[model samples]
Target chain A: MTVLVFLDPRHPEGRIADAAAPALLATDLGATRGDGVFESMLAVGGQPRKMGAHLDRLAASAHTLELDSPDRGAWERAVATALSEHLLRAGTGEAVVKLLLTRGAEGSDAPTAWVSVSPVPAGARERSSQGLAVVLLDRGYDSTLAERAPWLLLGAKTLSYAVNMAALRYAKANGADDAIFTSSDGKVLEGPTSTVILAVEEDGVKTLLTPELESGILPGTTQRALFDAAEAAGWALGYGPLEPVHLMEADAVWLVSSIRLLAPVTSIDGTPISSSPALTEELTALLHEAL
Target chain B: MTVLVFLDPRHPEGRIADAAAPALLATDLGATRGDGVFESMLAVGGQPRKMGAHLDRLAASAHTLELDSPDRGAWERAVATALSEHLLRAGTGEAVVKLLLTRGAEGSDAPTAWVSVSPVPAGARERSSQGLAVVLLDRGYDSTLAERAPWLLLGAKTLSYAVNMAALRYAKANGADDAIFTSSDGKVLEGPTSTVILAVEEDGVKTLLTPELESGILPGTTQRALFDAAEAAGWALGYGPLEPVHLMEADAVWLVSSIRLLAPVTSIDGTPISSSPALTEELTALLHEAL
Candidate 1:
């Protein structure tokens, strides 16, 4: 079951809509041209987490697409409406709160903004605990292309995700559970739907490393929160124009996202890789505390 | 006014739905991930044009996405239902018939397939006659990347067209009417929503040229039909690994697509280019006869 709320100017607190019923016009550009932006965050105990980061990214995405956005307050109220409904009916163990805004029906300038709250998929949590067998896939863009080609919308989390979904399908078909995307120039970028993080220890100093933001990967909110938490716990942090070799040489690698939180990678392209359970437990605890 | 007919197994003719009302689930993958395929064809005198080519391409797109498509018969019936309704209300003027197939709502195997019929945008025909001022934009992939990376879905006409739409927006923002995409390696690619065609005449013999299929552009149904008619009319035809220089040097250049037909290019990047009214008239006649 899911709950939906629409950000309507006439309804300052949002208009709760029936999710089981049809809720989008067939001509909505979001369904037609994929002309939209979205954010998905985790909700615990009826409260959304890292909403500031998600909303910031959503605004940036809307700006990139040149779509008008409902102000942050409208989104906050709508999300609250949806989450409160979710808790009422589902008693939220954990829910996925999705904020979606689309350039409305074709030929219309009004943007359609909505909030949807649903239970987190069971498979996501299962994979989080069971770990993932991963493969590296080419994202077909040179890292430097982002700076030169803003029209590509590389930094925006737009609704145009067919290639991302295709990459994940390709990975699953190849016997891998997930994929890490590499830039055409051979730099480690991010995963199909998450950020790639690697940990290392040298001279008894621990460090967390993620691909540099310049590589055109979506800045992971969960990853950002965990990095801050790790820093406070006295762990060093690094960003990279990282290569696959760094991942292969690291003490451990993980894919982190809002809902999945952190999923350790146990293998790469069928080759066994080190998985640090202790590090996973430590980071998971840290992430929980941060949330 | 618009008409929508959904292809459902229980309804051999289609399930007609109100286009004015909400008709798609918010969680539909087409709305969220753009995980789908679509074809847009023109309707003349209430009959869809080039439907065979469009349906073939739609099936190919569905296959590439690993989506289960409703059979050709189902699509045919749904399109008929939509067109019949369109003719009733719109009086058989030119219309656009769009076939859409989505991966359905999340966690569901069902595919959402529908046909929408609406009057053709007046601007499409106006621009076809006025010609377009086009700007070139980088598509951010090497020309050769298509074959090596099936995950890019380069050849498939999927619904994830945000980049394509953005390129057009960029062109319009920069004072051009439309955009022509160029690969990272400087090879001339297709236009944002159409295919590029150039004409060269020497010694009274005419040759039609377009970028080769291997460049991973969507195969243009109008371009293909025009090529067949032109070949039958004794014009030479050529496939190209074309560069921007080829477009500049050609006697005439046009962008061709199903709904907009053939639209000539008057200038590229603000530089006046050659345009041949005689060739445009002759080709337009041929395209009409072919259709």
Candidate 2:
């Protein structure tokens, strides 16, 4: 597929007219190398959901990679342009767009950024309704002091996604739709294919749980929005060192991401459970309003 | 680049025709998904030096990735065929070949395996004669434990080469030919572009040090061969948490790899250092005998 990208977000067209692939251009280093950072956003209609928060988190991710904050205005304009272009051409209200930041050739400090659009991947919606069957594997990451663990591309959506793909492959081979990663110590970690697994309690407490900061999972963008909604809706919200047994007994299970607002999970290890619609319903309403 | 490969080390082609590439009838998994392990060997003349050791390491790497290994006998024949084919066409002793192993599709594993050969990359010899300059960076990788890190496709020559290419780009942009990696704490690690470094202590202890098992650096085949040879030649070997300062002050430096035996370090971080012939002589002899 021919991808349209901004080699220099500062002057994106210069690259397009010159026919320079973002991956091939000198400044567009981080995107292809998975060097810099990235944020995947869900678009309902023409506007991106939670644009500001995603940008905020992207800044933190860049700092982790020791890169400068790419100009927010430039990024803002690029997204607006890409989305508007999408609307003008395809006219699809449902979309998923990705913003990728790469280290530039202007030395290690040069900031480079790009944005692209694509249709939502297949199976995300059905899985959201039916829930994903998952396997929990220990990714063996130490996420302690995660903010200061600059030696990792951890929180940042870097391009080095071989491990991530491998994790998904492992899940499929194990007869699961996706995987939930855990630590070596049997502590429940995030899913290999998604963010923290969320489950509600019988007392009407909406809990937002995933691996703690020490679990080496990429902090979730959509997960935070739901946590806020859970609180506003008068449900108790909390984070925990959730074990697999705890997840098995929860009121509902969902894999949160920008594209799939909350993909509720119905089974784990082939064990089926009842699905909770109220939690996913409230989460989506709050997310739409937040957007 | 059509080349021959041994299907199994023993068959040598009268048996398994799959040699490097599996039969087309076999389930196709590796090509699209990149789900397998591979090793690149530097074969000179008609023989692959350390071929047995290379195959052994390939199996070890496969085990780490949870992929099935090919029979030693079958693998050897496939490799021999690959070498013979390259020699038949190129008529050159100088060559580089790759061996690949993937889980076969017979069962639940992602299966496929094959081999490919190409001429040695150009300018390799010239670059070795006149050392390349280097810049250092953090791979978001702790150089410690990298040698055996679980998440690391480190020692395994997996399909993921994006980071390796980025390392080279980082070095070239810094006005150097390569980049050295370090721990997040600024402890010098391995070269982003190559293996850990080496030098001779003026006190006569032959030293070729890299980061420890915890440093997350891949153990180079050339480094291993050199160490064994150094030991046989009555020189002691050591590894290190080599700091940038320690390297700048070293009497000599060189990068080791199977294809490029020993490339000298002409300068580091912009400071010029005179090349040492004595160090190069010992390393060349060591690699030559091993290959």
Candidate 3:
């Protein structure tokens, strides 16, 4: 079951809406043109985790699209309302919370903003505990293109994710569980819905590495939190300029996201790689602590 | 005024819905992930023009996204119902008709499909008659990436058009009325919402040129129809590997779409370009005849 709350001017605490019923106009720009921004986060004990980071990213995405985002207080209240409703309806231990803001119905000036809470999917938990087989697909943009072409909205988490969904579909059809996109210039990038992270151990030191934000990838909030936690735990942190070779040579690799904390990547393009379950457990523990 | 018709299995003629009210579940993947395809066409005298081409493209787009599209007859009936209702309500001289299909509410296998008819926007007509100032923006993909990277969905007209819309917004913010995308490899591509077409006259021979479809651009229905009519009228045609230099050197350039028809580009990247009203008129007439 899912619970929804709309951030409306008429309701200070947000207006509760039925998630199973029709709640959006067919002509909403979010439905028609995908002119919107969204964020997904994990909730534990009826409280959303890393909401500050998610809301910051959502606001950044809206700014990139020149969309008028609601104030932080409104979103916070809506999220609270939705989570409480979900807890009442389903008594959830863990739930997935989503925040959505659209340009609204066609020709309307006001934007549409809503918050939704639902139980975490079984697949996300399974992927995190087991592992994922990932294929490296070309993302069709050079690593350096983001800074030059702002209109591409590379760093923004907008609703225009058909290509990302298609890439995942392509991976599944090609005998893989997920996909990690590589740039046209052959640099390693993020996964279709997660951040690519790899661990390298040298002598007695361990390091966590993720693709550079300048490479036209979304800034991974979970990755940032993990890196901070790992750093505090005496692990080195690095950003890339990484290639496919780096992933192969690393001691462990992970596709990390909010809901799927840290999922180990067992293979790349049908080739088995070194996957350290111990390292995954350690990093996941650190990540959870940070959250 | 607008009229909406939902293509439902229960409704043989399509179910009429109130466009002003909410009619879509917020969890619909089209609104959340933009996982859908759409087509828009102009209707004159209550009949949609070039509907066959639009429907064919819509099917191709859905196929690319692995979506299940409704039968052609269903879509036809919905469009007919929408157009008749629009005519009755507004008594329009011309109306814009849109066909939309979305992966339905999350976890449901069914798809949401609908037809909507509204009066043609005054801006579309104004752009065609008065021409437009267009800025060239980098689309961030290399010219040859489409075929090898099918997951990019370059040739499919999916509803994930936020980047396309952003490009147009970027142009407008920079004092231009529209935007023409150029591939990272320096090849001239189509406009954000229209096909790029240029006319050249050398040694008393008239020729029309557009970028090659292999450049990862959507197949332009209006461009194809216009080209067919121009060829029948003894005008030569060519496809490119076109560069920005070619556009600057052409005798005339225009952006063509179903609604706008033929909107001449008066400038590029803040520099004035050759725009011919006579050629726009001549080509528009041929296009209308074919439609």
Candidate 4:
């Protein structure tokens, strides 16, 4: 497995290879202490999707943990450089690029980084079509969401992904394809590894929504744009304490993210629904606009 | 600024440095995920106190995480080596040695292992004498504490010290020395950075109780032995829900750990306690028997 790396852009020292997967050293600071940050992006048609938004979120997450990050431009160039090299070879594959940054192998305060690419999840395409059956795991939301003051969540993504991954495993163990979390108080929150549930109201007058910045949910760049497009199209939008029951009653439920544009929900806790296809198509179109 | 690292007794390459710090890089399979286990012990008078017990607890934690540890003989040698080196230096300065083992840091599935030591907090002596104040913070009781059926938490001491440090910072900013986290239901749980609260009963019984393991509290090794000693000495021992009112009504409170045997809690959330010399003396004796 070839992994490339860069620090403040530049090769982050001679250790970074052009396109080879370099062996990464995970130190106490990185693995044992979970002192780091990570970002996963979908590389579509040889280009990094939503690069700026991802970088912005990364910076914010880094700031949250007092972790360091490569400067924006340099990091950007480094990524672009790698992507270009792969493209120059005329090789293309739907890829998942992960940027992982930690406090370093010595357990010191200095930031360590690694970049690696893997084949996009084999099930992703199929999952998008079949959609996800999700349960409320109650881990991710309970960790830090309840205390966040909306709007501030646009921060960089830190490395405390144990809970996130656990949520996914929990869902699988519980007979569900995936999991979503709600606030401890029970307002529908986000997927175990994705964004919130959104759908259009039955009457088609408004695009009922999940709370934005105020929800303390990670600001999904793709989801945010979709909502904006809804408004531009004159579809009224809302954000609130969405009871899980409400999403089921709505015309449609779409799980939005960077890779999968929208994964429709067939049921909520096993309750099936008959939502309007027109609404999903309309919202997805808006998602592109928002992007 | 010199740091000392003790290679795992299983030091993969059979390489162990005699001075300070290990030579190999930490691998990150589980450490990156905070998926490992660790134990901190106190080294005093050229000997590590309660070493067997600490090692026992560490083994239990590893079992909880399902991680493999080096053989006991290797562990003893590593500890013996590190302690002998420190003993030769002979300074009044206290030290903290942290042993971390996660999935390998080379990004291999086999966990990584690393250990290091640093000067202990300079004020430990002062705080032990004058006692320290505590602020109550809310780091909700982990939901899986009961059933003890693999809460990763049983093994997760590897990487999430950030939360512990953050709780400490919260206490400092709130005009207290450290933070004690209570359950969401207002039950007194352990501190975000330490274990249970202790107090002498008005009836003069030297009780050293702790919240039940089911109350989403980590089983504090120090507190466990104290309970046995308290009972052996004719003092009643109890455990279960720790309501805030119960904590506030006590005669004296103390926080126990591997490093700080029993730091008296003079005040909580800014409220002072009536110092109990009997409770202090008895608790100290119990701690001395074990640590």
Candidate 5:
């Protein structure tokens, strides 16, 4: 079951809508041209986590697209409404909360904004506990292209994710569970819906490394939280111009996201790699505490 | 006024729906993930033009996305029903007919397919009659990447068009009317929503040219029709690994699409270039005859 709430001027708390019923016009640019922005985060015990960061990213995405966004208060209220509705309907333990904003229907000036809450999928939980395999695919953009071409909207989490979805499908069809995109210049990038993180232990120094933000990947909110927590806990942090070699040589690698907190990657291209269960447990604990 | 017709298994003639009301679920992946394909064509007196080409391309796009497409007959019936409904409501002069197919709501296996017919926007007609200025933008992908990275879905017209829309918005914000995308490797690509066509007349030999399909541009149905008619009229045809210099050197340049038809490019990147009213007229006539 899913609970939905729309941010409306007429309703201060948000207008609850039936998720199973039709609630969007056919001509909405979100459905037609994919002119929109979205963010998804996890909710525990009917309370949303890291919502401020998600809202900030969503606003940045809207700004990149030149889309008008609702005020933060409206979004907060809508999220609250959706979460309460979810708790009432399903007594949520762990729920996935999503915020969506579109350019609205054709010829209309008003934008469409909504919040949705649903139960966490079983696959995500299973993947987080049991390590999975991933394939590296070319993202078709050089690492430096993002700075030169702002119209590409590379860092924005827009609704135009068909290529990302295709890459994931390609990985699964090729005998992998997920994909990690590599730049045309051969720099390591993020996964379809997650951030690529690697742990390097050299000379007794444990460090967490992620691809640099300049590489045109979305800024991962969960990664940020995890990095902050890890740093406070005496773990070093680094950013890169990372390559696949780094993953191959790392002490452990993970694909991290809000819903799937930390999913350890067991192999790449059918070749088994080193994975440390103790490190996974430690990071997961830090991440949960940070959230 | 807009008229909508949905392709339903129980309704062989298609089911008519109110376009102004909510007709799509908010959870539909087309709105959420932009995981879908679409086609738009112009209809004259309730008859859609170049429908066969559009349908073929739609099927190809769905295949690339691994989406299940409704049978061609179902789409045909839906389009006919929409056009007829549009005629009844608006007394058709020229209507824009769109075919949309989405990977249904959330976890549902069924796809959502529909046809919509609406009157042509006045801006499109104005742009076609009075040539518009265009800006050259980088598409962030090299011309050769498409062939190597099929998962990028470069050749498919998917619903994930946020970048395309952003490019157009950027052009307008920069004092241009439209945008023409160029590959990162400096090869001339197509426009955000149209195909680039150029005419060269050297030593009294008239020729038509378009960028090669290998450059990962969407094959223009209007361009194909015009080229066929021009060839029958003894005009030579050529394909290119074209550069912006080629466009500057051509006698005439145009951005053509199904709805806007043949819109001549008056200038590129704020620089006034060569344009021919005579050529535009002649080609428009040929294209109409072919259609």
Candidate 6:
């Protein structure tokens, strides 16, 4: 079951809508032109995780797309209403909450903002625990393109995710569970929907490394939180224009996102890569504490 | 006013739906992920123009996205039903018909296919007549990237058009009426939503030219029809890896699409270019006759 709430002007707390019914006009630009922004998060016992970070990223995405969205307070109220309704209908164990804001129906200026809370996918947790087999796919753009062409909306998490979806499908088709996109110039970027992280231990000093934000990847909220926690706990950090060889040489590599948290990558292109269970356990504990 | 017809298994002739009401589930991947294919065409006197070409392109787009859609006959029936209903409610004059097929709701294998008929935008004809002030924007991909990376879906007309919409918005915000995209390697590409066309007059021989399909541009149906008509009328034709200089030196330049037919480009980046009213008039007549 799912619960939905729409941010409406008349209802400052939001208007509850039937999830089973048709609720979007066919001509909405979100559906037609994919002119929208979205964020997915996890909730435990009615408490949303990293909501402030998610809301910040969402606002940045909306600003990138120039979409007029409801303020953070409006979103917070809607999210609270949806979560309360969802907890009443379903148990409060764990739920996946999504925030969406579209440019609205064609020729209309009003934006469509909504909150939805639903049960997390059945196998997502298991898959994240088991680790992922990934393939490197060409993203067809160089790393420097994002800075030169802002119209591409490279860093924004817009709803135009067909290429990302296609990459994941292509990976699955090729016997891999997920995809890590690489720039045309052979730089390791990020996964289709997650940020890529590499853990390096040299001379007993541990460092967490991720591709720089200038590489045009979506800034991962969970990754940011984990980095903060790691930094505070005396772990070194590094950002790169890294290559695939770095992943091959790393002690551990992970694909991190909001709902999945951190999914370790066990292999690349059918080749086994080193992964440290001890590090995963320690980082997972650190992430839990950070949250 | 608009008319909608859904391609349904139980209704071979298509099931008509209320266009005013919300007709799409909020969880539909078309709205969420923009995972879908669509084609828009012009209908005059209840007759859809270039339907065969539109259906052909739509099928290709579905193939690229691996979306299982209704067959051509079902789409034809839906289009017919929608146009007939639109004529009854509105008039027998010009209408804009759109065919859409989405990968349905999340977690479902079923596809949602529909036909919608509505009045064309009021200013479309006026804008086509007055021509366009265009700004050239970088597309951030090399021309050869399409062949190297099929996952980019560069040639397919998917619903993930946020970047295209953003490009047009950027152009408008920068005081231009429309945008023409150029490849990262400095090759002339098509417009955001239309195909670019140029006419050259040299040594008393008039030639119509458009960027080569290998440059990763959508093959314009109207441009193809005009090319055939021009050939029949003894005008020469050329395909291009054309540059900006060619557009500037050409006798006439146009942005062609199914609905707009042919729209001339009066200037590029604020500098007036060579534009011939006689060539536009001649080519417009050829296009109309071909249609």
Candidates' lDDT values, in order? 0.92, 0.63, 0.93, 0.62, 0.94, 0.91
- For model 5, how does the per-residue alpha-carbon lDDT over A55-93 read when each residue is reduced to its tens digit? 999999999999999999999999999998888889957
Worst 10 residues of 6 chain A by lDDT: A122-131
As for DockQ, the candidate ahead, 1 or 4, is: 1
Candidate 6's C-alpha runs over 4 A off are none
Query: Taking the tens digit of each residue's C-alpha lDDT, what string does model 6 give over A1-291?
Result: 888898999999999999889898888889888889999999999999999999999999999999998999999999999999988999787899999999998878999888989999888977776889999998977898898888999899998989999999888999999999999889999998999999999998999999999989999998999999999999999999999999999999999987888899999999999998899888989999999
User: Which of the two, 4 or 5, has more DockQ?
Assistant: 5
Candidate 3 lDDT score at position A127: 56
| lDDT tens digits by residue: candidate 3, B1-291 | 789999999998999999998999999999999999999999999999999999999999999999999999999999999988988988967999999999888999999999999999877678566978889999988899998999999999999999999998998899999999999999999998999999999998999999999999999999999999999999999999999999888999999999988889888887888888899889989998899
Tens-digit lDDT string for candidate 2 (A168-257): 766787788777766545677676446765666756455666657555577777777777776787767667677788778877778778
RMSD over all Cα atoms, model 1: 1.0
lDDT of 6 at B191: 95
Query: In model 5, which regions exceed 4 Å deviation?
Result: none
Per-model DockQ? 0.89, 0.09, 0.93, 0.29, 0.93, 0.84
In model 2, which regions exceed 4 Å deviation? A1-3, A7-23, A26-33, A105-112, A143-148, A202-204, B1-154, B157-219, B227-281, B288-291
Can you tell me which runs of candidate 1 are displaced by over 4 Å?
A: none
Q: What TM value does model 5 have?
A: 0.99
Per-model TM values vs. the true structure: 0.99, 0.62, 0.99, 0.81, 0.99, 0.98
* TM-scores for chain B, listed for all candidates: 0.99, 0.84, 0.98, 0.84, 0.99, 0.98
A12-59 in candidate 1: lDDT tens per residue?
A: 999999988899999999999888999999999998999999999999
Ranking by DockQ: 5, 3, 1, 6, 4, 2
Model 1 chain A weakest 10-residue run by lDDT: A122-131
Interface Cα RMSD, each model = 0.6, 10.6, 0.6, 5.7, 0.5, 0.8
Give the poorly placed runs of model 3, Cα more than 4 Å off.
none
CAPRI tier of model 6: high
Residue lDDT tens for model 1, B64-164: 99999999999999999889988888897999999999999987899999999999887767766788999999988888998988888999999898998
Error of 4 at A100 (Å): 4.0
